[model samples]
Target: MSGLDNVIAAETRLSEVDGANGRLVICGHSLDDLAGNVPYEDVLALLLPDLLGPNPQAIRADLGQARVVAFRQLAHLDAELAALPVTEALRALMARLPDGEDRETALLQIAAPAVFVPALVRRQAGQGAIAPDPARAHAADMLAMLTGADPGAEAVRALDTYLVTVSDHGLNASTFTARVVASTRAGYASAVVAALGALKGPLHGGAPGPVLDMLDAIGTPANAADWIDAALVRGERLMGFGHRVYRVRDPRADALKGALRRLGAAGGMDAGRLALAEAIERDALTALRARKPDRVLETNVEFFTALLLEALGFPRDAFTGVFAAGRVGGWVAHAHEQIETGRLIRPQSRYVGPQPAGRAA
Candidate 1:
């Protein structure tokens, strides 16, 4: 009924999306609690308590080594695959990975995006791919691979906050798509690829790029109120202000905003741009509250998400892929959770068409 809204599909222990309260809890920890405080690999261990080995350090080493393996295996260019968009290129390249429900496949999927996305970026620019450095941490290595030099401490710190904040969030569209595929006992690769396809749509993972576009258009803080009025007059949806869930400010948005500030203090952020983003958020919030008096429309993940990822040196187009790099861990965990259910996710359908050639019309 109504696209299965309010339907309880499956019970999960990984993450909880408390849209009513605008809270996100991962493995019994808050998004605010986990974002900057925990390294990404530690969060990975927390999500997969049973799967990861006893030594968390070894698991970190394993993931680091896996990134190296993905780098070696996938760095060589396939013209057509490299020519695809970053997320699609990742999806295509993932098709070649050894597919399974085992830990090995899960580990590879987690690491592949970090390698594959930058490779796609390089090949698009007619440059060579950078090899992974196993010694570097995941967030650092990912940025290092892009810049061909070690990223600053704040840059890696910002990226780690991003990856952890987005590591898991209830059953979003992409996570749901992955679980549906996994429910049928398809391999992890199939589920992840399907999720990537679903995330490619604008309503979901394609949001952050346009947030940047809006920023580019506004240019300065002085323009915020005027731009808001004109956009509302033209019936344009403000890119980063609303979310399907979250009646209050998205907690992730707050987390990323804090990260943006940290990066600013580290000298990677532009002061004027930060001021402009904050001004627009304020103006947009006021306009939205006045427009929909009964509904809450506060800044969602896309707002600061665009700013944080842009500060991290990713192109607008690669934002989705960078998102996948962080979210792939959750996809793998959700796939395993769905598989444990041991039931196919076959939802019922009702049709309103004329029945049996007008026999019941």
Candidate 2:
């Protein structure tokens, strides 16, 4: 055996990720191309074949309705529940959604994050939530609802790009958790909750906020190298650099970095943070390469995810919550796929203790 005991079946239906080549293709289109051209909701439709049929307009309409319903549910949640951290609140809200056994239910489950997570963030920050607007595109409406201020065109576009870029990956840890949950015939909510729990770890969706923390400590471009070196000396892993899957550079990093630049321009944010972050990326890569020549350490998506969310007026604490809003689509789709396959996922564990003696009885 090659030691991959989990029996992850490789697929070629839509997206294919070649980690060794550092390439990602979605719907027979390169990630770079789709990230530039497609809206977030359209990409969601592409990823979910059953929930969203061939008609893009109809899918958007259905998703809009789902968003409205989910938003109302979010508004009714008690202040005590809303006081929890955005990520936990989001998971709780998602857990309450019905199982996606049919098209309508699946759409509702997919739309929960677009509605609830942003509302939870606003509520936690002492801002009242805004209801979803069916007329507006999903990403634009989400930003407007969360911030209670209409974002500029470029800002909305940037947010859309980010959401589309992260909508799905082949089978990352969180997606795998989602699939595993679905394989057991659990409801859509359960799978998404499992994904969210995995995402809460520092190694997954938790990395972006710390990138901002690292930048705050560094304070300026001149101190970037020293701060990184000091942190490395103390056995700290740099927050936004390097990825487990990609060898050369993460393609998502470029897409998000572009979005961040656009959003920064729209928001009139000072470029100092961006510049310092770039310097840190370069220095971190160099230092990492010097220390371990054989390992591939390059800039990953979290690097620019920090800058983008900060520019979009999100607090550091809300980063992972925002990620859930994008990834919930993928989790729902994966859950449906696993459920359709109807497999019970029960992986065997190797017991380390002494084996049962043949004559024990």
Which one wins on lDDT?
Answer: 1
lDDT of candidate 2 over 1-361, digit per residue (tens): 4446345664435567777888888777788997756787777778776667867678788888888878777656887778888888778888777775578777887777877767777777777788888887788788888788887888887887888878788788898898888888877878888999999887789889988889899988889888888888998988887777788788999998888776666654668877888888888888898876888888888988888888877788878888888877777777877777647777787776776679573
Q: Which RMSD does model 2 reach against the true structure?
A: 2.4
The TM-scores of all predictions, comma-separated, are: 0.96, 0.93
Ten contiguous residues minimizing lDDT sum, candidate 2? 3-12
Residue pairs with backbone atoms closer than 3 Å in model 1 (clashes): none
Q: Whole-model Cα lDDT per candidate? A: 0.87, 0.80
Best by TM-score: 1
C-alpha displacement of 298 in model 1, angstroms? 0.6
Q: Give a tens-digit lDDT track for model 1, residues 6-124.
A: 88888999998888898999988889888987778888888776766545577678888888878876645578878888878888887778788888888888888988888788778
Candidate 1 Cα misplacement greater than 4 A, ranges: 358-361
